[model samples]
Target: MKTFLFRSLFGTFFGAFVAVVTTISIIYFGSIEQLDSEMFLRNSLGSIFCGWFFSVSPLYFEIDSLKLPTQTALHFITVTICYFVLSLGIGWIPFSFPTILLILGLFLIMYSIIWLCFYLYFKNEAKKLNAEI
Candidate 1:
């Protein structure tokens, strides 16, 4: 839908911007002798596409009144699949068992950390609101 496209487009540009900044930082701080401009451009665009795809995927989680756990589970499953597929397609991740397992493990750790942070943030906000009432 429209919202999906909007989110995807936003992510595409943001991801590309981040990718460029990261590359620039690396190049500024260290030598990237083997990396040519063409390769860099190609990789940047690919990353943008990956980001767009990832963003659009969240549309599946937009159902109203769903339990938090259900929403989280859906998001995790959708994003994992989307990330794996797009990463492999873009040559960011190789198609291999070891690589898949490694990626999944890292994703799991990061996902848990992010969710915990969100939970804590919302809990604090709720406490503040209750105090004001």
Candidate 2:
């Protein structure tokens, strides 16, 4: 019970931090220009909530053996690929190599930081729980 509660709290905090960072990056990069203030806030909150959900989803599986680094890498790759494909489909952004690479690079860096923090927080909590045991 204690372990679960600790993990949940840490995960939530990590998710929120990641979301804030992501939101800031998007705004800084002009990605949120199409969104009004209210929409931006809502999207930011939603993305943060989604991040928490993604972070916790693995718990249902074998989370104990999860390789944080590998998982983070794969997550970044998957997101980048998806965004690239989506941009191509929507024609919202010019499908130029430089633009795609820039967007993917920025997102990858931001998300990597977020995931790294979550992984560290979770690892620390697990260590504490093990010590208690």
Candidate 3:
């Protein structure tokens, strides 16, 4: 449906933007130092994509109104676990703490942004649907 597609796309875009901004902020805050621009960009982008994928995966399923909270909690737990695991795995690579934090921070930011976008989109869609009736 249009609503589903809209939410998914919005989520993805919002996630990526947030991840980029967070990465920039981390760099600005001196939390991360980069010697190689290409590697930093690649890791940041990868984190963003991973976050978006996990965050949006749960919403693909349909749920009743009453079950929304439970579904959301499950989604959060799953995403957090996955992100942490992925971050730790990435840390094993030849990167410093700052680099690792920058990557993980971007991932968290993406997750937050996607959730916010989904919330706003769903709220607006619900309102429109109600108005149509």
Every model's TM-score: 0.76, 0.47, 0.45
Q: Is candidate 1 or candidate 2 better by lDDT?
A: 1
Most accurate candidate by TM-score: 1
Better of 1 and 2 by TM-score: 1
Task: Give lDDT tens digits, candidate 1, residues 13-99.
Answer: 988987888798888888765667776876788778767877776565567788778988888887788777777876788889999
* CA shift of 99, model 1, Å: 2.0
- What TM-score would you give candidate 2 relative to the actual structure? 0.47
Error of 1 at 11 (Å): 1.7
Tell me the lDDT of model 3 at 131.
Answer: 100
| Candidate 1 lDDT | 0.81
Candidate 1's displacement at residue 47, Å, is 2.0
> Which lDDT tens digits does candidate 3 get at residues 7-67?
6677667767876787788789866666467766666666666756654657634666637
Ranking by TM-score: 1, 2, 3
Candidate number that wins on TM-score, 1 or 3: 1
